[model samples]
Target: MKYLSSGTKYDSCNQSAICHAFGPDGRCIQLYKTLLTNYCSGECTYCPNRCERDVTRVSLSPDEITKITWSFYRKNAIEGLFLSSGVIGEPEITSQKQLEVATLLRQQGFKGYIHLRLMPGTPKYILDQIAEVANKFGVNAETTNKSNYSEICPNFDYQNDVLQRLHWTDRIIRKKRKEFRGTNRLVGANDTQFVVGAVNEPDSEIVNTVSEFMKKYSLRRPYFMSFDPVPDTPLSENRPSPLWREQRLYQVSYLLKEYGIKADDFDVVYDEHGFLSNSDPKLELAKANRDMFPVDINSASFSDLIRVPGIGPISADRILRSRPLFEEKELTRMGVVVGRARPFICINGKSQASLSDFLEACS
Candidate 1:
């Protein structure tokens, strides 16, 4: 099946099809994903759409987009549009043009979900307007660490351009939600692809940066696009980030959200080169710092409870609630996976093994 507009097809037999609703009956509702224009002026080191690349570029006119959307809507082929564009000029001009497209859609009474990707360096007013018109507002911070950002996206400055734009849009969305008396429903935040192995940054740094952003900004869900090396980019010869590293980054991110572990609390060690790949970062932390675990599920603090290998936030909560009645062995039998936990957790006043002994065994 065709998943992208680039004439790329997938194996239809291997995939399942799904559907959703639009505003009213007779209206179609598929995600209308397309580029506003393929012509980008930004000289991002990793982007194939950079102005320096010699490729077929297309810019859909406002009228063209409107007509296409309407036809798709009438056929129940799409529910809303996800319109993104390359930086055709400076951010200000590009943002204005993007808003114009959304404005036209609104003026035409197209009320389906509109997801727009804001151009970096767009003025606050323009971003606010885009947020007002679109159902979701997305910005690509690709990498949150400033050093990696500077190296990969050389044309764009993180603090001056990207962060400022995100802050502005975030402020506007929150304010507008308040003014309109909308529920805790948030206007979202979107980040784009990170070039993993192109730079020597660790997964810990990436998770830390994202966690900080979520905490400080009340950001909506963050999307991670795995680094895929395109053949002609400046870093094409650089190896792609290992798949496990990307997966581990996401796993650690989930743990941060679910169990409240700070990135700093977990000490992830790299080999002589970089990035520890032998086991999950959290598991590695518990294994190395035996003093921290085989925590007494019956008596450990919420923070302490989380350090156990197999226990997550929910399991810790259960332990806290059930401890007054259940014995350590009973709790272990109830699917706590105490084999992992036994290495780091304690029962009543005693650990299954001494902290030093456990560390020595794991070592």
Candidate 2:
């Protein structure tokens, strides 16, 4: 309940749950995110619902879940549903219940977005059924590597269970895309979540693993969840992962997924411990390559524009799209952070702002 109620926005489909989702027509839509049931049989060391102790076990029937979701949807409380559940008896059993909710919603003409979790080891047929009704799918890889998987979630298989399910999700979504031809039923994207700092995995491994997935599968992006120790769990004695580390990962992920920034480029920000430092990755890169400063916004390439501190792909493209060009003040209007970008950008092939100015302004 602590985790759920925290309402910490997760990076799913390039949007946060705290901020509402935009519909196809650009309307904002709220999502009702919840778990189907908290019951589980797996003994993942970090999970509160792991089968070791006498935790409260609760399960909601598929019909009950559908009623609650439908009621909310009809009343305009939510525009969609984000449903997940721990493995009840088997992966298939839990998956079937989720599929039921999706199917029922679709049958009732509920066309809003539905993000469903693909349970590990779920059969291909069940996955196909889920693809028919879901807008996006998620399978949490939790850790970076198989070796780390043993240290963290020993009950689950890294290859056959986790990776294979991700593979199936990619394949099914592709097949659905071909079948639907960009219809609403076509699942737009898939994502994975990683338990950052668990099993002592470094940021490099986590980013690299997600990069590999992006290359092979049709993965949209990866979500980073800071490891928070739950009471009575085996990992309760371990130190909780710093939230700043998770925030750093998200920034790095945006650079990789949105800005086309390569994962190898992260070597510039990683410390001796192989973890990302508290400094923002973009600022660190800028600090390291001082020669690239004072980029001409009017003449700089799209790639170079993104390398600047406060300019993103969208704002950079907006700058490029302007016909008559823009003044220094106009940069902020185009969504550029003038305060952060001033030192790094040149308005008319002239450098005015300095590192000292940037430091002082930032301070």
Candidate 3:
């Protein structure tokens, strides 16, 4: 249990459940997170279980995984399973093994939430089989694009293997939901993940790729796993990507998904290297586009309001509903962080702050 769980942590399924929230039907409450096996054949340079690395390897059978899950479930120790794996051999073969695990668990009368991650090249047929039992499915894109695979994961054909499988998962899930539409039973959600800083790409590239994904593929979410160089891997001597970089990626993704912010809106926030600075991205964007500031509270559209530093969609909605007024306190009362938004917002045509006021407040 310990070895398998540790091996799968690098997958960062919900940052290994540390900094994410899961609240539907309490299905994720105490999930039994682990890998089907730690033995792997792929020679990815960053993984401890890569074919070139020397490490203790273990694999659990479908029956074993099913039994262990039920033992924990019966003891009230867990409510669901989040199972991923080290690629045992071919992608489809490894996925079939995991499908067997989920198949056995279901046959055992365990009707809990099961999240099975498909290997990058796993085909649609096997994906169809697995979706019968798993509620959520994901395939890790691993990095921004195919070019980066040459650096750390040369064996992967990023477009055909990773990107295509993601498309397949999305299509399959959508088709299944459509078939089940009138039954009030939507059973599948799909997500993709990336390893931050592994291939030396900028945040702009990451943001743009993720924006394309959310727009084109209807990606439910994008996961960013901070790349911590593992000892004995080829990249072991390289510095680990900071956790804050991973956090920034999440913030950018949220801005893309919920705020309806375009990827180009973030272009100005990037430094010369095309990376976001170690700061709030929204604030940086707002500061960079200073001319758009001092937006009228009463007349600004929802789109304009969310572009401000401290005003989020919720507060923006509240402001809209309670609008045609005067006073900064109303903004604060509606949930805007007054200190952050005050410099950029105007109430009833009364501009709140000047350049000196902003500079003085900072000083």
Candidate 4:
């Protein structure tokens, strides 16, 4: 279990203030994310344990995982369990092992959040059983589309295995919400991850796919894994994706989610190669659309206020609720990042700082 736990860091669902998983109630949780087994049969080029890799293989029985999860939850060491696994044999067989662990936890009176991984192409019947005990679930798409999956994981089917399962998970979550009102324990479009820079696909395609998923499947958001070559795997020598690229994608995605920034809005954010420059995406967007900046700090709507580089939803709403600002320092009190927002906003129709000054700094 110790070694298996280390491998799960690849999945974005395992985040932190140290394993920080946010519950349905908007509380951050420490999820006991660990692999059910590290043994595998798939031959994916990027995986460390893709059947052919020489690594120590281990499997924890369903009963064993249940004990581990329960012990953690009881002691407040963790608030949840996120059970994922490598394909020990068939995908379905491995999925069953995950379900059994959740079942045992539920039976043990584990009321905390339980996030189980749904293997690609898991049949609807299995989804139903898993949903009964699971508060949330995920299926990593790994990449943007079928063609991309072919390059990195030739044996993995992006459609039947990955996308179809995503479609099903969305439906089940919706159905359960109707059957049991106020019981929608789901978050995300059931959530997914993509290995950014895994292929030569543009950031446009990645963000576009996530936007489409959000619209079509009610995806709350997506997590990105900046590609880092693993030793002894097929991609070991490939250049690792810069951490800034991952950070840029997250900012762009956040804009898409919170500020309703659309794909077309990002056209200038990319270069000739269709990649974002290593810079603040929000500032880039404001710079490109100069007319939109210098928005009246006091009168700007919640939507327009958040469009400013340093002003977020929280500060935007604060500005809205407490209006008619008399001084610039008031902006700071409401949580606005005054330094960044300086060039993009005005108070009492007075520009905070000339836009030319900001542009000069960027150069």
* Winner by lDDT: 4
Q: What is the lDDT of residue 312 in candidate 3?
A: 97
Please identify model 2 stretches exceeding 4 Å from their true place.
1-29, 323-326, 353-363
- lDDT, residue 236, candidate 2: 91
Across residues 199-280, which tens digit of lDDT does each residue of candidate 4 receive?
A: 8899988888989888877777688988988888888889889988888998898999989989888988899988999999
Give stretches of model 3 more than 4 Å off: 14-30, 74-79, 182-186, 356-363
What's the C-alpha lDDT at position 60 in model 4? 85
* lDDT value, candidate 2, whole model: 0.78
At residue 131, give the lDDT of candidate 1: 73
For model 3, residues 252-347, the per-residue Cα lDDT tens digits are 988988898899989899999999888998998899999898788899999999999899999999988997868887777888998898888888
Error of 4 at 130 (Å): 0.9
Off-target runs (Cα >4 Å) in candidate 1 are 1-31, 62-80, 104-112, 144-147, 180-186, 189-193, 219-221, 268-274, 319-339, 346-363
lDDT at residue 169 of model 1 (Cα atoms)? 64
Instruction: Tell me how candidate 4 scores on lDDT.
Output: 0.83
lDDT of each: 0.66, 0.78, 0.82, 0.83
* Clash pairs for candidate 3: none
How high is each candidate's TM-score? 0.75, 0.88, 0.90, 0.92
Ranking of all candidate structures by their TM-score, best first: 4, 3, 2, 1
C-alpha RMSD between model 3 and the true structure:
4.1
